[model samples]
Target: MNIIEVEDLTTTYNGHTAIKNISFKIEKGEYVCLIGENGSGKSTLIKTIVGINKKDSGKIIKNIPPEKISYLAQNNMIDLNFPATGKEIIMTGVQKHKCLPFYKKEDYKKFADVCKLLNIEDIINKQISDLSGGQRQRIMLARALIRKPDLLILDEPCSGLDVNITKELYNILNKLNKEDGLTIIMATHDLEEIKTIGVRVICLATTVKFDGDIKDWKGEM
Candidate 1:
């Protein structure tokens, strides 16, 4: 089943075209990667798909529920001194209504399960500001998983992490895609990590340059 279909999608900023015309389809439970150099419309395409930036033309058909699609951007700009615990930050993902006065017991249980699944239980009580860079990334991932999103959209998920941590994150993502059958669409420039994850690769150089098995990338910039 096609979870997302984009036809002739285009985006412009101040009359400058970011993505000329692009088309693609993401299947259910498929792990797809969006690759391109900087200023090559990778981020524009993602923003357009997620509705952060309005497209200039074409169509974006999302068959999945809006809430079921979670987007984790490169820079997660949350205040460092917000005074929120890691668990609380994660629970925010599961909270549907922002105005809700209290969290139910089931919500807490779900949060705990997600933490355990991401191996972030030890940092649950720690403040978000006190965690390491890799730990913070894991916490953000746990928060995304707490909502049980059907389609996960990640932009440069392993940007600042060390090689070892990047490998660990890839392992978790691969497990999530294979074991839980979650559909993942990630935009990244990490070629090595891409090879390790072994997903379908979609290279966007202002348009759909390549889309196929990652093993066949050919290293063609």
Candidate 2:
């Protein structure tokens, strides 16, 4: 089933055009990668789809409800020294759901299960600042999954991680996509590296350039 559909989408910032006349559809259980240079509208497109940025003129139809989508913005933009526990952060994802003034026992169990799935139980009690880079990433991912979202969207997820940590993150995301049938849409600059992981590649540069299988992608910005 198609989870998202965009038609002639356009986005702008400060009256400057960012994305121009782009269109695409994302199906359930698809692993899609948006690749481009620094100012290539990749972020704009994602922000538009996620409603962080409003479209100037276009149509964006989401088959699933807004609450069914979970987004992980760039880590660099997030304050890591918030003095919150990993478990605390994960529980925040459930705030959108119907719950009492405090989390119920079932809520705690769900969060614990998500942490276990991400192999982050060890760091659940640690301060967010005390965790290592990879561990922190896993914790963030656990938070995203705690809500049991149908679609997961990440922006520049591998920006500052080491090679080993990046590989581990890829493995975890692959498991989520293949084993659990989760839909993933990630924006990254490392196209050549993510080609093997993504089923479809969307290259953007102020407009949609390529939208097809990774094997058929031609080299260009």
Question: What range of 10 consecutive residues in model 2 has the weakest lDDT sum?
Answer: 190-199
Estimate, for each residue in 48-160, the C-alpha lDDT of model 1 and write its tens digit. Answer: 88888999899999998888998777745567677988888888788776667588888888887888888888898999889877888888888888889999998888887
What is the Cα-based lDDT of residue 208 in candidate 2?
83
Q: At residue 167, give the lDDT of candidate 1.
A: 85
For every model shown, the clashing-pair count is 0, 0
Residue 164 alpha-carbon offset, candidate 1, angstroms: 1.3
lDDT value, candidate 2, whole model: 0.86
lDDT tens digits by residue: candidate 2, 1-221: 99999999989977799999999999999999998888999888889889899999999999998778998877666688889988878888888966666988988888878987878878899998998777888888888888888999999887888888888888888889999999999998766567767578998889888889988998776
Runs in model 1 lying further than 4 Å from the true structure: none
